[model samples]
Target: MENTHGYIPSALLAGGIAGTSVDVALFPLDTVKTRLQSAQGFWKAGGFHGIYSGLGSAALGSAPTAALFFLTYESVKHFAGSETHWSPVVHMCAASSGEVGACLIRVPVEVVKQRAQANRYMSSLQVLKNTVAAEGFSGLYRGYISTVIREIPFSFIQFPVWEYLKKTWSEYQKSEVEPWQSSVCGAIAGCTAAGITTPLDVAKTRIMLAEKDSLLSRGSIRYALTVVHKEKGVRGFFSGILPRMMWISIGGAIFLGVYDKVKKTVSKYYLKKHDHIT
Candidate 1:
């Protein structure tokens, strides 16, 4: 195998492909999750479709975010051109870059998704129109500040933990590990990160899902926190922690496992082909 550190591109491409697949496959769960986070009272009225209503917009938004995340991370790695075994600092930087790129693309779509998830009656287009009318072009980005705040730390933990776990696991395996192993590692990483960031995640969800006309206002992250704290108390901030952790872990496992395997396969093939040409 041609051992060069240009593998970041391969990693990014693989991550994007894997992430998009995971997002689509688990979107129904995500819809439910958002609803759970954004719920106003004890009543959980929505059915499966109600919960998953905004999946279409999510799909559209997630694909690019996933792609951009990996692309940005890879570009950063290439620019840095470091050969040292990936350190926590390096992984943190890479993850931060990846997440920031993804979140920038994802925030508006996330707002749409949350609206669809929160209200069963609202169609994706309906929500989009309502948001535009109520809040204008800027309204679509309601929870962006919270999203960025949550995602930066979330990515910092998620990527490094995932890389470290996978590398550690790979080292333990005497022979080449299967994709399943990678999946397991990914799941662990996802769960760990989700647990750490659940409060912020809830805050972001509330900010996006809040009613536009309300005095509290939908755009203010502080307002969202204030509302949740007033209504639900500190425990409320962790409302969807269980489901979120489960879903994230499973999704992470599948995403990372597939991504790592695909990238490895592609890099191997590319290297072999290059040698043949040489």
Candidate 2:
């Protein structure tokens, strides 16, 4: 087995491929989850159809974001291993760095996707144009603060938890476990994290997508929290906690498992070629 503590460019390459592929495959579900999170009466509007609108925008947004996240994460992990210690703190820091890098690029795309999902009638381009015209370039980053808040903890928990679970599971297996097992563990970790962070996500989504005249007009984090508290109290902030957890768990599992498997496969192939050359 390859040492988990060494630099591995092949893993980063593989992780990128896996992450992008999984995002493309599972984006429709993500669109559904986001709609459910953002909408006030998501179920009453049109049931699943209402919730799953604008999947196309989600697909576009998720692909690049997932790719960058996995690439940055794997690369960071490899580089961090060069240090003397590989403690939990190191892992957390590495994961945070990766998440921050991914989110920087992802925030604009998320705005576009959220806008499209929030308004079923609008296309991706229409959302972009309207946002640019009204709010200018800054408008594209509507919920950046919330995004960062959500991601830092989310990534910090996600990476190390997944690594721990994968390692533990591998030890129990008679042979190398399949990718599906890793995916399952990833899903569990994702669900746990999503549940813990649901309130923050709700606040962020509302702030980003609120109308100009609404009480959330300023798009400030404080404004968003106040709106939710007034409208639905503290419970209001966790509106779609159940569904969000379910979807995130599933999505997380598939995403992480695919990333690990792809990276492992690529590394294996590359190593074999190098060995033959030597």
Winner by TM-score: 1
Q: Residue 30 CA error for candidate 2 (Å)?
A: 3.1
Q: Please report the TM-score between candidate 2 and the true structure.
A: 0.86
* TM-score of every candidate: 0.89, 0.86
Q: C-alpha displacement of 164 in model 2, angstroms?
A: 0.9
Off by over 4 Å in 2: 1-13, 43-47, 50-52, 82-85, 174-177, 213-219
Query: How much is the lDDT of residue 134 in candidate 1?
Result: 82
Q: How much is the lDDT of residue 51 in candidate 2?
A: 46
Whole-model lDDT, candidate 2? 0.71
- Every candidate's lDDT: 0.78, 0.71
Worst 10-residue stretch by lDDT in candidate 1? Answer: 1-10
List model 2 lDDT by residue over 61-103, tens digit each.
6656666666666666666662444646666887777778778
Q: On a 0 to 100 scale, what is the lDDT of residue 144 in model 2? A: 80
Screening candidate 1 with a backbone cut-off below 3 angstroms (N, C-alpha, C), the clashing residue pairs are: none
